[model samples]
Target: MEKISVFLDDYRKAPDGYVLAETMDECISLLYSFDIEHLSLDHDLLHKTRNGFMLVQLMIKEKLFAKRITIHSANSVGGKAMYNLLKQAQRDLILSDSTIVSLRPLPLHFFPANVMKHYLEVI
Candidate 1:
């Protein structure tokens, strides 16, 4: 089986099976080094660097392909802007169409249905 490679920015926020990176460089390097099915980006990434953080820009610029990109951002402005920018980049061939998804907080009893749905649909 091909393992899913995930790049998670925040250690505490990261889900299982993710490789967390503290720096944008490390994150981008991991992104560049492999093909990933999913990526989790935190709003804190923007705090580390402007333009919605370096990793995002790197993914946008390089047009790094992924099955999905989930942004777990608390900052409304940054989150919305990042979502739009990612969409535009994809439209402009700066990113892939199947890449970039906005992650939403689910209820405790939701049973991760949406995540499972995405995974099943992808498979």
Candidate 2:
């Protein structure tokens, strides 16, 4: 499987080395197609009805997950909701026990380069 990084956001331009998915459907397509090494999600999208939160719901319902997942929405409420749900899924054995889930409130403009490196650490 080809390991790839996915960035799901409608507005933010993904930092180098990430496959940018502007919409939930696009993100889901990538989720189904590749071995996602790292998946960073945003809660608020241009299409609120089909935002990152909804993506999280679909991911859980469909058992679609990555090796590592991060909720990087600036919206604290939505980000935490997504993060907590994923954490709960892991706890409940719904998602892979080894899959690391994190809440990182990423800025809309500045994306830390360390984040890409952070996910590459030996688990």
Candidate 3:
């Protein structure tokens, strides 16, 4: 079966065409076990915890990935910082359209139904 890995502390609504993985470990395992075509990350996983960063680094080191990654983070300061960190890693990123793109080439994409479809087709 096709799988999409998600690095998150909680399981909320999936933005269509994606699946959810409860923990970072589960996310990685899914990537190792299935054809993960996409990934979704939540920035403030535990507010003060750096699990989000750790998960991304692990994926980078393991070379486990989907074709694209999207961030569904809180629109808070910490969230932006976390998003920035991911961009520095040079991962292809998708962000909500409300956010302004500061980093180049990483692809700050928008969310919601239509934009998501466009992103899937483009990437």
Question: By descending TM-score, how would the candidates be arranged?
Answer: 2, 1, 3
Taking all chains together, each candidate's TM-score versus the true structure is 0.70, 0.90, 0.58
Clash totals in order: 0, 0, 0
Evaluated at residue 68, the lDDT of candidate 2 is: 90
TM-score of 2: 0.90
What is residue 35's positional error in candidate 1, in angstroms?
A: 1.1
Alpha carbon lDDT of each predicted model: 0.60, 0.88, 0.54
Per-residue C-alpha lDDT of model 2 across residues 46-90, encoded as one tens digit per residue: 897999989999999999999899888999999999999998898
Residues 11-83, model 3: lDDT tens digits:
3555555566656666777878887555666644443454555676776566655666665555455456555
Clashing pairs in 2: none
The 10-residue segment with the lowest total lDDT in model 2: 114-123
TM-score of 3: 0.58
Model 3: runs farther than 4 Å from truth?
A: 1-11, 46-50, 91-122
Off by over 4 Å in 1: 1-3, 50-52, 103-123
lDDT of 1 by residue, 8-115 (tens): 444344455667765566667677787777766655653466333456677777776567777655566666666777778878877766564665432223436566
